[model samples]
Target: MLIGTPTEFGAALERRRRELSLTQDDVASAIGVNRRVIGELERGKGSVRIEIALAVAQAVGLDVDLSART
Candidate 1:
């Protein structure tokens, strides 16, 4: 999916997490982050650190690819 906004990223993460049958706590524990952080990221909180957000995506089996706009 082409995610252009924080909200889109968060929604994708949440959808993948659900598809994988993972709870927020499961992702948090795997990534060594607070559960609340997961919630915040899933809610599209713009303040979420990019590293941490990416970590959550990784934990949920999501990949972020960067490409130049055509």
Candidate 2:
């Protein structure tokens, strides 16, 4: 199953950030976004764009790429 959602990905991103000792502000700064964006994402608000989510994943060192070729 190919499962992808901003909320799920965002939660993963948050987990990775914490594992790396990074705060929401840290990720926001690295991704050029506001801390609220990170908070909203982590909470699964579901209004953020996919590109932004990818940016968050990258900034937080989370694996964002998909291996869709099955």
Candidate 3:
């Protein structure tokens, strides 16, 4: 899916997490982050690092494609 905003990314992440039956802590551990970070990501916190967010997506089996902005 094309993520146009942080909120969209967060919601998608949360939904994927639920579909996998994984918790915030589980994703955090998988991505080498803390639960709070996961919470923030789930809440659409725009400050989340791109690398970390990508890691979270990877951990949850989501493929991300970051295209160049025109």
Q: What C-alpha root-mean-square deviation, in Å, does candidate 2 show against the real structure?
A: 2.3
Candidate 3 weakest lDDT stretch, 10 residues:
61-70
> Which sections of candidate 2 miss by over 4 Å?
1-5, 68-70
Q: Where does candidate 1 clash, by residue pair? A: none
lDDT of 2 by residue, 1-70 (tens): 2336666666777778899999999888988889998899898878987778879877776664567566
Q: Write down the worst ten-residue block by lDDT for model 1.
A: 55-64
Ordering by TM-score: 1, 3, 2
Candidate 1: Cα lDDT at 6: 90
List model 3 lDDT by residue over 1-70, tens digit each: 7788899999999999999999999999987888999999999999999899999999999999868989
> Comparing 1 and 2 by lDDT, which wins?
1
lDDT of 2 at 9: 66
Candidate 1 stretches greater than 4 Å from native: none
- lDDT of each prediction vs. the true structure? 0.93, 0.79, 0.94
- Stretches > 4 Å off in candidate 3: 67-70
Stretch of 10 with least lDDT, candidate 2: 1-10
Q: At residue 12, give the lDDT of candidate 3.
A: 100
Greater-TM-score candidate between 2 and 3: 3
TM-score to native of every candidate shown: 0.97, 0.79, 0.90
